[model samples]
Target chain A: MEDRFEVSILLDFYGTLLTDKQIDIMNMYFNEDLSLGEIAEINETSRQAIHDSIKRCYKQLKNHEDKLKLKEKYLNKKTEKENLMKELSKVESIDNDLLEYIDKKLELIINI
Target chain B: MEDRFEVSILLDFYGTLLTDKQIDIMNMYFNEDLSLGEIAEINETSRQAIHDSIKRCYKQLKNHEDKLKLKEKYLNKKTEKENLMKELSKVESIDNDLLEYIDKKLELIINI
Candidate 1:
């Protein structure tokens, strides 16, 4: 489950960098939790081909992540935004209404 | 000048997807305003080779921008954030201090 989740996150960041076939296979394998044999059936390829394609997809995705670190930077920014929200919540002297407004805006920015 | 600026902005969003040689050549040609002959001299390549590389780099960058629209989306977001800041500025009856604080925060978010 953990491995699948990590791959999904990587796909989110670097999926566009992949070929359409690699992306489709990855979506089935990681997102849909499809087995290699099932993917082979759907892709109309042999199990060995499906296996190799998935392996290559993983390698390419990991290589992109390693070179760009887009996923890592994204996660770091998420953490930073969360921390900022916490600190904003802790501010005691600001008007409560303004703080609430700011909190709402912060959530929007982080989601972006 | 306008074309060069547009290319530089495109490079900013999609440059990591490019080879290091492409990036270096682009930086020399665009950012440093180097002529093809100057770049060729520095790279120890023929001027025609430098020219061809730059042309290919432009095509590749344009292709990436066309597929992803990252630069267009980035420009749109910048405009949206600026519009948002304007709207935030026009709100009446809020504490001017709180408004100033919010403006600063908004700037930070857009710059991110």
Candidate 2:
């Protein structure tokens, strides 16, 4: 379960850097939860080739994250923004429209 | 002037990945406005070496930015946050405390 979530986050961060074939295999295995043989059948490749491509894709994603740490920075910013939103909500006499506007800004930060 | 600002932005984005000597040369050349000969004298290297290192550093920074684009993404988010802040301030009956809190959150996003 933890590994699944990690792959999802990795895909979010570095998926664009991967080759199209790698992405297709990853989407099949992780997103679709297909077996290695299933992906091989879909792509008309050997199961070993499908497995190897997925492994290579994972390593590339990890390497990119290791070099950049963009995902770590993004997660930190997201946590900080959420905490700020909580504090802003607690401020006395804050208006609903103002709160909504602030919420929108925070959503932008987290989504980025 | 435009080139100076570009270097500053580039430095901000990829300064971490540069070698210590490269960073020193960049700081002296761009931030301190030191000439190549002056930087060479300070670093005890040839003026040509200083020039070469600065050029290499700039290329490395540009390549990093091309691959990741974190700086570009940051600037876009900052612009969006500023616009949201402007809209937030225009909302009716927003208290000073709420406005200040929202401003703080926006600052956090921009600074990130």
Candidate 3:
């Protein structure tokens, strides 16, 4: 099975669009790593109800991702940042201040 | 007036999402730097019609950009790339091969 970690990543991109209750449940399930029963206990709902809500919310996040692809572009930029950083680390003679400047700029590119 | 060049930049980021006809007219107006009458002559439509269409399509492009901010992010990354390139150019001690690789990878980050 795929890792639940992806849900949290998707949440980072799209969590604001989701309802407050949905975001709460998702945080508990994905961020807190709580099972449905644990979430249900805190929310005063049945485990089955929490399960259904989580399923629906996951679908919503996936739909948003499929349409906008913000996460995909972010991952691509991040990979580029990593590759450039590796190259920067290998060069022995570059100045410390220059290295720091390049590093910060590279991160700024990926920060979007 | 704001630069018409911006529409072309926005088109580069969000053009495919626009309809074929809208994109065609946008290209004629922004890319070709054509006036409304010039666009209408080629499309066999009135200048007013072409004007309205351009207005609508510009609005559509703005809407997509508003929701996604892909253009904003793209510009940010591009600026970051530019700054890094400038810094690289000033550093005379860096090896040519390493410099080229860094430039290419920095471009890759903004490619998205």
Structural similarity of chain A in candidate 1, as TM-score: 0.84
Candidate 1 docking: what grade?
acceptable
| Candidate with the larger DockQ of 2 and 3 | 3
RMSD of 2: 3.0
Candidates in descending TM-score order: 2, 1, 3
- The C-alpha stretches of model 3 lying farther than 4 A from their native spots are A1-4, A11-68, A94-104, B34-46, B86-92, B95-97
In terms of DockQ, the best-performing candidate is 3
Model 2 ranges with Cα > 4 A deviation: A40-52, B42-44
User: What's model 2's overall lDDT?
Assistant: 0.79
- Whole-model lDDT per candidate: 0.75, 0.79, 0.81
Cα lDDT tens digits for candidate 3, A5-34: 888888887786788999999998888888
Local lDDT at B72 for model 2: 83
How much RMSD separates candidate 1 from the native structure? Answer: 3.2
Can you give the DockQ of every candidate in the order shown? 0.27, 0.42, 0.44
Give lDDT tens digits, candidate 1, residues B1-112: 2389989998887788799989999999999999989999999989999988988889988887775565675666566656655655665644567566656665565445
DockQ of 3: 0.44
Q: What lDDT tens digits, residue by residue, belong to model 3 across residues B1-112?
A: 2258889788887786777889899998888888889999999989999988988888887877776677787887788778778778778888788788888877766776
